[model samples]
Target chain A: MTSNQDHLPTGQPDDGAPRGKVIVSVDAMGSDQGPSVVVAGCARSARSDSDLGFLLHGDSAVLEPLVARQPALTGRCTIVHADETVTMDDKPSHVMRHGKKTSMWSTIGALKSGQAHAAVSCGNTGALMAVSMIQLRRMEGVNRPAIACLWPARGKHGFNTMLDVGADIKAEAEDLLAYAIMGVTYFRNGFGEERPRVGLLNVGTEEHKGRAEIKEAHELIADHAEIGRYEFVGFVEGSDIPSDRVDVIVTDGFTGNIALKTGEGTAKLVADFLRESLKSSALALLGAMLAKGALGKLTARIDPRRVNGGVFLGLNGTVVKSHGSADATGVAAAIGLAAKLAQSGYHGRMAERLVIAAQAVQNAADASAQNGDRS
Target chain B: MTSNQDHLPTGQPDDGAPRGKVIVSVDAMGSDQGPSVVVAGCARSARSDSDLGFLLHGDSAVLEPLVARQPALTGRCTIVHADETVTMDDKPSHVMRHGKKTSMWSTIGALKSGQAHAAVSCGNTGALMAVSMIQLRRMEGVNRPAIACLWPARGKHGFNTMLDVGADIKAEAEDLLAYAIMGVTYFRNGFGEERPRVGLLNVGTEEHKGRAEIKEAHELIADHAEIGRYEFVGFVEGSDIPSDRVDVIVTDGFTGNIALKTGEGTAKLVADFLRESLKSSALALLGAMLAKGALGKLTARIDPRRVNGGVFLGLNGTVVKSHGSADATGVAAAIGLAAKLAQSGYHGRMAERLVIAAQAVQNAADASAQNGDRS
Candidate 1:
């Protein structure tokens, strides 16, 4: 591995960008496509946005030549070499106990130490969450961290914000309230939507439907809508996730994880079936040829890689998780999302908003308990 | 309301078929398309399957002319006039209390009195479930009724069976185990799969993931795999819902309902986006015309109307809930599904399988409690 002195120091203005530019700390190892794609993605971002820089963490022996090959990243990157990598199959507990030398840990370290504003990794989700919580720890008054994703839907932003996709399976009423506030912040910052409408995910839209925790969450989220700076849509069914009725959806990780995967699986299934059907005849082949341009456009619109990042929220700093199998294009998308969040100064504002949400939840709990006592 | 004698009696050699033919009692009112579609759908089925018969429940004034218009139903129909109809906005509890005169209630009555081998309705889901539960009651040893659906997927059968989609949102460990057994039985009897692979839906595939109920259900379902007459694949994530790995997915109604709707929403979103893209350019329009046959084939394969019924399991009699907005083709498909179940004698076998499942769960609970005492 190359020594730290081999790279330029922070705010050296190597790329003609100011000190206030957002620098994304990237874990350039462990992904299926390897570090070449990661370097290419960083170069792509650097080529598009002069105000963005990258602090790439990996084995410099492997990464140095890759970075040198990209002229766009010649003066816009700082390689922070680490000796090890966290494999996809590594257990979160095992990695947490002994993974300090890994590139993923070093990437998060850059964020923790303020060397970078945001972090991006294509590592195992569980291991990343464990390392982030152990190193940077949760934000003030946050019991559990959440992972938020942009769901492609019908809206001004073309996507709806959804949280707790797989951070943890269990979330009590209070935790859901915290997610509501965090999701609102994410939508506003990432999508540039002011006062996004939020909804609680449930089996039905009726107040009496869903589990007890959901009912409690409904009351808490609705009661503090004014403080959260979002309109409370009360409850929404799964179909509403992609509808224009709301801009943000909040749910426990168990439900959110399944909903996310189910949506992806359904889309993939449709695509597969359509391809097979299109190949069934000569006429279809000719038609597919003529419609290739239109079909390509549709493919681009629904491509998961175009929206490839899940932000780990309720943590001390923002960490975006890209798909492990993502190529250069997908990795670049994730980095772009991370840079946007960092540029908006989302980290500082998030802490302030979450504290207020915590207080509102406590007050709601107290009022509910008093009513329970009376009954 | 017309008198009961206005309708033909059961097994009166009506449709030129023998006494063993499957007869579906259909609620011919309250659907978004009204009684005309229901009558037309029945006529369509009667034309396709010469052995099929219908027990139609609705206003005789409206249904008589519609049924009489179709030559296929010349001697194949029986009309049980029901003046009242349950609207979509009616409360389930309210319907259960004062819905005896409603068409939905009358349709369930046909199943209860054994006047029809099976029941199908396009009424409100909540109202339909409520009326069926009261009229037929739950089967012995069944705790909560479940609504099972055929999820379109890739497999030998082209679909997977999922249960507890909406009947009840809360399913305990024992209830989930029951669903596993019920799902396997439904898959076998409906699709003729000798031994379907079953999986419990959870946040992840790991043993340590998900809530307390899921963990318990995992153990209970795994322990009684041999007795359940299916292979227990343990836990499955959301993406596996459509994979070839599992033929049956058992989950609580809350998660199952959300997953179903989420899948539908994603599919619709893709279709809409694809349509918009196809219409964007003249070249694409010409291509679409050339590929029209193949595209139509794809649409037919994934059409919801081709699989429109949601079967209410754990009931003394079989009941299928069709989509409220179904056309004649959709209604015909739902009635076809109901007729298949009735022909297989699914109601009687489901009861026996559920009783054995209950005992298995009880045995596991007792053993666990004994271990707790030792601890």
Candidate 2:
């Protein structure tokens, strides 16, 4: 489906800041509404960034109409005419097998084959993870891949990055250490943190509490030299995410997924509750006026849409997974997030650091083994 | 230890309602603070409920001064003098083997032997679950045991029942059905609902989502006669716990724990944030004054202390697990709750209902197996 000769037109002039030429392959037919929203998002992204090029992979007929709607994107976006699309309900194995023909699969293939700098999709997360793992594979010294997302916090547009949203359901202590290192790198590079403080998600702030894995992970991270660059602030709970307690929060995928959705669900409930309370009666309305500013600031600052996507870490290349129900704006934001990660070199830095840490831990263990200090 | 015959003075006559004869066995020396707070909580509980009795198992000499401070409790509460106490850090297996003389063991024994109606503790949950599994055993026809708790919801001063708080970490679909039946029965009897609506926690309200287990469990529950009795609303998210969405929300223990704790942590954080915002400046103080009434009402409704305790269901008897960090008042409220559960015959009735339902499901499955009706 690489018949883009007819669609290719003159590219835009380079802007002041030398924008790195990034080819982001879009799964044009993956989302709930098919290629329409994806095409729109890619069009928006391409128009805003001159160096960013889009290799839209889907049915050309489906793309032509959507492309017709956006005149500005006609020359900027390339259509890779693929016939198949991956449904959200399809098994991960099926997607992995026939992913070459499907838009989502082809997108990952583009990244792996060096045709695209990064790939972005709002399709089945399981399929994305599986296909990406098959095509791109894990980074050096990384055991498990993690999905890291930005959690907006309390400061001026304040946010903290969190990882292992839904990559591995069951994780080990070493998996958590990997998440900590990846999350630290994601934040440091993507958000420009010098030394991000990593907090382990636990039931309490105590050292001995939480699951067995987190406790062991804490010890491993604390002793690792590369991870030592990250200010390991021991343990933090789910509430600490929005309170500006730490720069990065690390957890297994199961807990992290629940926490993320819970936060999203609660925020919506709170907003709804406030609206209902405000409109219930005249007295309540008057009371609402007093809270209007503080409440507005809080909600705006913590808006999930502003940080609408999560980057799957430990993979060989950048692959951002937008929320399945993302609108055009959200998908665009995800594409932007993928671009930032591609430029940041966060994954490379994190991979290099992880190798050093793992080697050091292995060396220490080996020395201790000689000394008969297994405990 | 049960030798104080004169201390069983039962006459706190004529409060109109029947004064329940409840004997609560306390593991007086297991928590982080040892027996100090637990003894204080028990003493406070005894004073509050005149008909309440305790088999406080621990060193009688150590508990004597604490028990002495409460004159009213001295009459009804008897020290079940056991010198040993289980340490929190001890392995569950170790405690099970060498725990005979330990206060935690003795107190549970009191319940199993029918000396007490229920058992209460702030000790290690893993140990408690293990001990209870061995001692009390599962109710008749129950396959796997689950821990249930009542989380406070808005509206009436009632609680919504949730189960498998920490009993079974990784759950099967059938396991969730057991949790549902147990949760509903507990809600009906303990919380006085005739037919509680059961909502399964999922990422979204869609029919074809969630991890594999939740999806399978959803169908099983829909067809089960016991589950059919309740208003089986399809799916609900974590945020619905606080607001009135369902009478009982069912999930695996892992997700349930995170959701419950996240709700708690969110409430605490929002409350803390508001309080801090109020004290920030004079202008903020004026705003706070304007919104004080609504905020106060909101805070009171969402206060964690009001619903500090949770019931550990699916046991052969009643057992309540209060928050480890619960204060005297919170402990007293939990004790009061346990007394009410005993008075209501919640556990026995729930067990009876579950037996009937379990038999029906097994019969249906057996019939299907015999007929070779795979579909």
Candidate 3:
């Protein structure tokens, strides 16, 4: 299937045709709901953007019936038959074994072969990361891939980008600097921020209060001349995240994962609690009627579906990771994010910046050595 | 120093006898605000709980003025002069170097010397953990120390205990099993729960969805006879945390810290958002007025301050960690928690449970080995 529509804005209407028209391949069989929800999302995404195309990878038997149900989805999205499906429980090593057979692996192959600008998945995140790494390989300087999510701040300044959501569990302080650079590049490209402020997530604002790695990394980033263009704010506690104090919040993958999940869970709990509390009594119900519109608007704004997608930054090619349990709406949102990132050249800009950042880190070491010798 | 009053819910009315009393050594100079707030919290706690005593550790001169300003506090809390203070920036290695003089170190020393049953700190968490490890030591059978917190669950079965909130970042699968058993013991003793169901936090409810360590730990816990006594309900995602589906949640320190912070941040954000939305229009305000009491009760119930203190579960002696930013009420609640733990011999029970659980794990391993051989 071919379309000559150019690119569109993620959620809103297309303002102008994007510079680069890039195809994004969606692994239809990756998520829990299988090809139907993914196909519907892909259909919705493809309709919104001109430059987007989908290469649906799944069992033709299962996928064809679902695609047949939506005739409008037939032309915009292409179904590429692949008998292999990656189970959520499958070993990452085993999936990496057949690089071209499985839908998940083949989707990454599509990116490597330039059939797709980026690959989006709600599948086994581990297998996706593993396949992405082995197939596309890491960019010149990136040590490990990081999952970056856009978090909405309280004020009007917009969402803050955070990273290392679930890719690397035990990241060193140096790895954190990489996350900072990548996260900054993402915000610069995706959010169009030239110089985003990067805040290191710590238990306290004091630079030396965290672990040895955090302290060491703090010195490295704060002193680096190359990072001068990017605003390097000091430590930010978890409380500062919802505030519009910083543009990029950087932490290790383990912490980032927990933060994302907890934020999601708490938001759900809050929404549920409000609904239950509002209907408890007749007076409360009357109060709810008066405040219904405002509450609805607030819920819609804070809904996880509205902010469904996150990009896996620092990878060789763009890989957007949607929440595994995301429904059609969330999936659609993720597709939109991927489409926008592809149009914005988010990965390319980040890759370029990372190379320079890595070199600067090396140069600083050499300068430090020279100074020591001179003394 | 003594007052006969039934201020708090204790077994007996104040009899002017300090029966089953708990003396907490506070590092008055450890926190950001210094001795004043610590002293204030101490006095409040002392007034509320007559069976409590304090050996406030800090510089006598600095504390003397603050003590002199409040005659009521002077008799309630006694000052132990520790000339130096461990600044937040002090190196953990060097933290204990001047242990004899620093307020934080001396406070820990009190716990070590049996002058205090527990040491409370709102200071440098890392330094406190370091000094505590050096002084009080880890509980027998615990390979790594864990910071256990009571997570507020929906439907109010009190609070669900979970941990390794900020300690043991790089933990093994076996360590997680140890944490689960430890958490079960903690919930049982601290909250008096019978057969608390334990869940390993993962990306999904599926047993094999998580990393290798989680999968292994899941199998280990499920098979262990002692662990089996407390329902090993398998994997739980972040959403399950607030649902009260499980009474105990176990994960590594890295994720636990993130989850804790995320919960705190989101709770505050939601509360703020609700308050903001409620003020948008006259009707909304009217509605809010109608449900004011219910909303107030709900807010008070979910307030993090009520469950502010976290127990450093794997310590040989009961060491409760109050939030660094906790106010007087939070500190008092923590003191009450510590007192109860000390009174209940919580540490000893934990030790006993751990030994049994470890033996069960070993037995299960041997049985599995025999089955594998036969196969």
Candidate 4:
């Protein structure tokens, strides 16, 4: 399926010149709303960021028509044709085996080949993770990769970063510690926090509660906090996930995934309830109209579309998995996040921090072992 | 500490006659608001159900004055003197060892001794669970007891039942199967549902996702659905907990507790945001005033106090735990739940269901083993 489109410009300066712009790989297909939303989102991103460029991966015939509609994105984008798209129903293993020619795979490939700084896709989460793992590979000493998402919280930054949102079903003590390091680094780089406070998610804040692995992970994270450049806030209950006390919450993939989905579901339910109440009567409807501006502000503050990307951490390259059903606005938010991470050199900084933290953990373990032998 | 209160009527019929009233044991101390709230809650419950009586366990000197203030509770109450109170800060093990004379212990003691049909306490949850496990004991063939709570959902009953919401942190496959049995039975008895649909809570509804024990529990539950007298919906996600798809969501204590508290936190956050918006400006305030009636109705629908009891299942007797910070209304709701469970003979019926379900699970395991051997 190799074609003339495969030879498109890599957006990299040749002649040993300094790179002046951040290029983001965009998978312009496989979204539930179709390629139009992806193209529109790219257009929006290009309008906001003049220095941003895109290596759009999909059928060039289809993407060209959409890109032509937006004059701002036309010159900033390079269309690379891919024959196939990764369907949401495709298994991660199936994608790993036979998805090389798909848009999702090609998008991640751009990041691996150094043609793009980061990758953004509104496609199947499992397929994307599988492709990214195979192509980009995990970081050194990282047993499992985690997906970090910025959750809306009652904090100074109005959000907290939580990881292992569903990279794997289980997490060992070391895996959880890795998650803590990754979450802290992600928040620091993505949101510009100097030193984020990390909390281990558990049933209770007490030292005696929760599973054994959680307690072990808590101590490990606490021990490496200084080297990791983050403060350990001990254990935090589920309620504290949205509280201001902690900026990074760490947990196994199972709990994190359930909590993430539960939070989303609850938010939607409350919003629906509020809307139903506001339209219950003629007086209520009229009042809603009068209060539209303030209500709109509240709605915008909690809008999932505003913060729509889940960043894949502990990998060689940055890959953001947006919600499959995201609209143009949500897709734009994901692309914006990817560009910000790339511009800030998040992946390289995160790797450096994790390596230091991992060594400190090893040192602590060795000391504890020697102490046990002496006793 | 023995007083005239100790000799007070037990509410059992005089002249050696059979008891007709459903007597609920109440711990009148250790609430965040203290004894007055408990007395007021008991009085409120008494006013609604004439056949409901209370064995109030606390210092008679403190409770007598409060009971006298509520004249409706005078004839229907029997105060029992207990010299100590289980402080919220006390550890569960400490309570299990040295909390014999505490009001929380005395309240549960009445159920073990069969002096009261059911027990209701608004004390420290960890201490209460410890006392109940030691006092009532787990039912036959049950590995661990579970705490079941009715969650606000979009179901036909406007709620769904979830179990192991912090009774213990870990649950094996057998323990999960037991939770399913207990949860289904609790929903049927409490909400008058003829046959509740059971769903194993996981990160995804797909059969191959989640922890190993979760998958095993799914098959066990599906195997015994007919004998357990419930329909197994295979697996359900966190969002399904608040949806109408299932009536009982079975999970380990860790996930259940996190999901429960997360939902509570999200609800409060959304409510706070809505209130702030409504009061942001004079126009918004005026609009809120016009829509106050509908908003009040909506608030009442999601009010936590309206359904405020967590029922401890898989034990020999029924125990309902109210929120430690519960007010008079919340305490009343707990007492109401205890009375309903007592009146419906929930403990005896649940015990029978569990026995049969447990045997079915054992039989399935044996059959699987035999098949393996034959192969």
Error of 1 at A373 (Å): 7.5
lDDT (Cα, tens digit) per residue for candidate 3, span A78-120:
7777778887877777788864678887788888888887788
- Give a tens-digit lDDT track for model 4, residues B1-375: 012111111222223322458899999996899999998989888887788899999999998889989988878899999999998778899999999999999999999998998899998888999999999889986898888887778876778888889899889999998898888877776566777999999977767677899999988889888888898898998878888899999999899999888888888787888898888999988888888887887787677887788888888887999987888888888887777666665556667878887888778789989999999
Specify the CAPRI tier of model 3: acceptable
Instruction: Report the Cα lDDT for candidate 3.
Output: 0.75
Fnat of each candidate? 0.88, 0.20, 0.53, 0.68
**Model 2: how large is the Cα RMSD against the reference?**
7.8
Those runs of model 4 whose alpha carbons end farther than 4 Å from true positions after fitting are A1-20, A60-62, B1-20
**TM per candidate:** 0.90, 0.79, 0.85, 0.92
Name the DockQ score for candidate 4: 0.61
Tell me the tens digit of each residue's lDDT in model 1 across B1-375: 012111101122223322466778999996898889999889888877776888999899999899889999988899999989998878899999999899999999998998898899998887898898898998887888899888778886778988888998789988898898888878877666778899999977878667899999998899888887899998998888888999999999989999988988888888888788889999999998999999887877677777788989988888999988889888887787777667666566767888988887777679989999999
Clashes per candidate, residues 3 or more apart or on different chains: 0, 1, 4, 0
- Greater lDDT among 2 and 3 belongs to 3
List-wise, what DockQ does each model earn? 0.68, 0.22, 0.44, 0.61
Please state every model's RMSD to the true fold in angstroms.
Answer: 6.3, 7.8, 5.4, 6.4
Candidate 2 vs candidate 4: the TM-score winner is 4
Could you tell me the lDDT of residue B136 within candidate 1? 92
Give a tens-digit lDDT track for model 3, residues B17-92.
2245678877787656656777777777877767788888889988888777765565667788987887777767
